[model samples]
Target: MTGSASRPRAVLIAGPTASGKSALALSLAERAGGVVINADSMQVYADLRVLTARPTVEEEARAPHRLYGHVDGAADYSVAHWLEDARRVLAEAGGEGRLPILIGGTGLYFKALTQGLSPMPAIPPEVRERVRALDLDAPALHARLASVDPETAARLRPSDTQRLMRALEVFEATGRPLARWQAERTEPPVLPAEEAVRIFLATDRTALRTRIATRFHVMMEEGAMEEARALLARNLPADRTVLKAHGMPWFARHLAGGITLDEAIEGAILDTRHYAKRQDTWFRHQLKGWSAMTVEEAAGLLATMA
Candidate 1:
């Protein structure tokens, strides 16, 4: 989190989808002579750029943007990979005498950058496949995890398959609990939170829901389905994160003739709303000491920082 005696190193803009985060990031970058580095997991994939609502060509032309749409759809991109990319971008921005404006809806990226991520060993491919193939219900798997890694199991809810499976996979691969690896992290924080302007956009819940639905419909109209069609043609692994991007699976179903377009739209809208809610909840609890404000308020605050 070190910065020059004169100025902070970066500005972090975090919020739920459709919360105007991209606009704010662009505004801040324009003002602060910064480069916009992506923090969103979905935006990293090249295949679902429109579906992920990445910045448009015009918006990007206005400023230097890095790490967006740089990943292939079939690659198993992870948070660790993003962290490494972000570190390099931050260095590049610094060397260019520009601030690094990290923006996205993903809280984990912010957490990893600020708090430092555990250099946990990778799970073997077979271990990943074995865990993904298990059809056990959440509670059953939680019970199994409880036996091998009771500490992590107790911390996570029974319904949280993502974390539970990750913990199980880590233990199965390395014969050590995920918690143990996390506790042994030796890396320093990537970006010190104390030296950054951290802004979280908290919009009106009903208005956000409206924006999510409206923007999703816009994506459908603006070639999101075509993006999905191309991605489907690739036949990427189902377990890949790109396949689970908000509304992606529903759009895929629609393209496959398994569902009506209207139904697909409704399902995508519902899933996005759920995801946004989770993002809001996670930021509320996980991100501490960040100033939560509306888009306009954030812009005004960034002016002071500039």
Candidate 2:
């Protein structure tokens, strides 16, 4: 009774893609009076709804969902922005006395909730312009980043252009590498991990791979090709963030007669499965403190805690 006297009954349902997290969140919401909170990065973009797998029409109707696909596709949203939004939702839910179930596959968002996010400054335009001048070749950018932020560079795969650009931009803006800033900060989180029941609903890799493949096929059958083609005809920049949605370019090309539909489907499935693998590795290594449990187990734990 002493420990249960004051607990903010919140639930976090997170895992890799195709991990049945949405279903779990729905179930938890029904039983616990919780509203689902968006945690997926791609799902935050309004334009990539189908490609990003934002929850379906049925799912949204099942429970209240906050902050899904609410951002401009062109807008740059960081983990910090998401954390602020999450705090607002948490506050609202707490006031309403509704259970708050944060759900998605984004490990970084969960990390930000448990461990304080670093207060990194915005990159100055001059720094952005400088990095923009460098060729986009993977190795060249990787080398450039290595010269500035060796710690981040050492971990980045050569092909990680997004991260390489970010690392270099941070170094140029601050006149110091990102690694230095990260090493210096030691602030506690706004929410202690113990305050909420945390769960990472990892699925079996093989089963997840099959689910990814089947889902991609379903997507195509459900008009994904048309979706890509429509976006392409908008004449958005190939480098535009929306144009680069997962598997979008390939489907756009395939629809344009540059490749067979069969090849596009295969490529899309492969890319998603690979992404799932990376998510698995990240949650396993980086989230060492959060206790790992299946979705049901996590719900059970939360129930007993209350």
Candidate 3:
């Protein structure tokens, strides 16, 4: 693996939703001649622009943006896919002599970029279908995983249906626990920590809660409902990642006459605030060696780079 000193410099901005990460990244990118890359998983889908709070058209017009709204909603995009796309974009940015500024709240994407990822075996379509069709709730799935792969099951939360399902599928396909495969990871980090300026934007909890609620309201007024309608019109599978974008389920309920628009808006707002809390917690615990600062402080630090 190449040393960090041999790698080109990049910037990484991460934080909870409504934390102004996009604005900071755009401001720095425009002044520094940097390419803004999407690190948030949901923002990559073309179908959830408003709900995901992806950069607006005007924002994209102001600077070079990569990987935003570039994936089909029906596809099951994963961190592996994101890392590959990021590698390509980072290379492109380097070749063009532009700084690469990756921004998002997805901690796993940043982790994979700096710490590499495990190489899991390919899961056949039949195995995936079998695992997904087991007619079990998350806790039940976790129990089932315990029977086959106790180590992995113990590590995953009983409430995490997606990860439980993935663990089950891995065990079924390879006759080994997912943890075993993860232990064999040999991929090198694409951008080592020493080669980049990493910052996690911190906001007071009360202020962040207010911001999240306000942002959801703005999203709805700006056509989040219509965006949800279009995405639902596609009839993607329930398990598709895009279907679970924040506010989507609530909007779906509202559109289906199961709830009023006001109820939908409130539900979306509440859920988003909860998600933001989770994002903040995850970054604090999982992302190490990252500078934590308010937006203004980060901007000041980044201005020097420009």
Candidate 4:
């Protein structure tokens, strides 16, 4: 076996957007005859393919790929939902004795694989809507959560609307604080620690920011505006998962005459730069223990293994 005898062979290729994560994963999969598994949250949904920059069809044909572009936009897919999907794929891949390569930039997906997830049920859409309508005003919503579930409320930052809403809903539905429920449901990680080698692509932040900005420009040149326009014209509320895509809001601003196309495109670049910075920060501190390698280094490393 490629991995420890007790655990199935697996490889993880993770990094920020526009960092060539998909290419690396595909190369590794081709070398090892491994199956590529999607680990990015956005890439799971069926819609927003061009926006999410999912793997191209030619790339999928180069290796066995799973879980890419599988769900519809209407689904409020959570980490729990993704975990369930991954667990099934892991089991299936292990049974077939095929190496599994989990790849993408969504940090939470990797976190769930390694550290295990809290047993929180999906929060209702209405409850989430109510929380979001509170409009990122931390103090006011914090005050509301404090009245009903002070323990859970105490742990959340005032601006954490998504989490605060989840905690509040759990309290209302179960008559218990969300923290208490988390305590009760902690379980062993589904993906064994020794089964996989974790590798992170380390690109220079400045270089990566330039790449992000450049890619957004390419996306625009490649009909991203039309894609965004169609998606926006769907009349889905701003809070819908599809409408909240990273580049959508800025483009929507342009569409609504709030800004010019030039300004909107510039905003997209700036936003992507900031997103890359955040991803770099997360990979550094949050994934501190993982092996860090450059793109060239990764290619060399895979060559050796092959």
Give each prediction's root-mean-square deviation over alpha carbons.
Answer: 5.9, 6.6, 6.3, 5.5
The digit string of per-residue lDDT tens for model 1 on 179-211 reads: 877788546888878978788999899999999
Give the per-residue lDDT digits (tens) of candidate 4, residues 1-306: 245433337777888788888888888788777889998867886767777788777888999899998987765666667788999999898898678889887776787677676467433332344455556466777887898778778888988876776776655333456766677866677785555778899898788878887777777777788888887777765445666666888889998999999998888788667676677677677664687999998777666554
Stretches of candidate 4 exceeding 4 Å from the true structure: 1-8, 118-180
TM-score, structure 3 vs. true = 0.82
Per-candidate Cα lDDT values, in order, are: 0.83, 0.74, 0.84, 0.74
TM-score, structure 4 vs. true: 0.81
User: TM-score for each prediction?
Assistant: 0.82, 0.77, 0.82, 0.81
Clashing pairs in 4: none
Model 2 poorest ten-residue lDDT run: 1-10
Model 1 local distance difference test score: 0.83
Question: How does residue 268 of candidate 4 score in lDDT?
Answer: 77
Model 1 residue runs over 4 Å out of place are 1-7, 118-134, 137-183
Top-lDDT candidate index = 3
What tens digits encode model 3's per-residue C-alpha lDDT throughout 19-86?
99999999988888999999997899998888899999999999999999999998767777888999
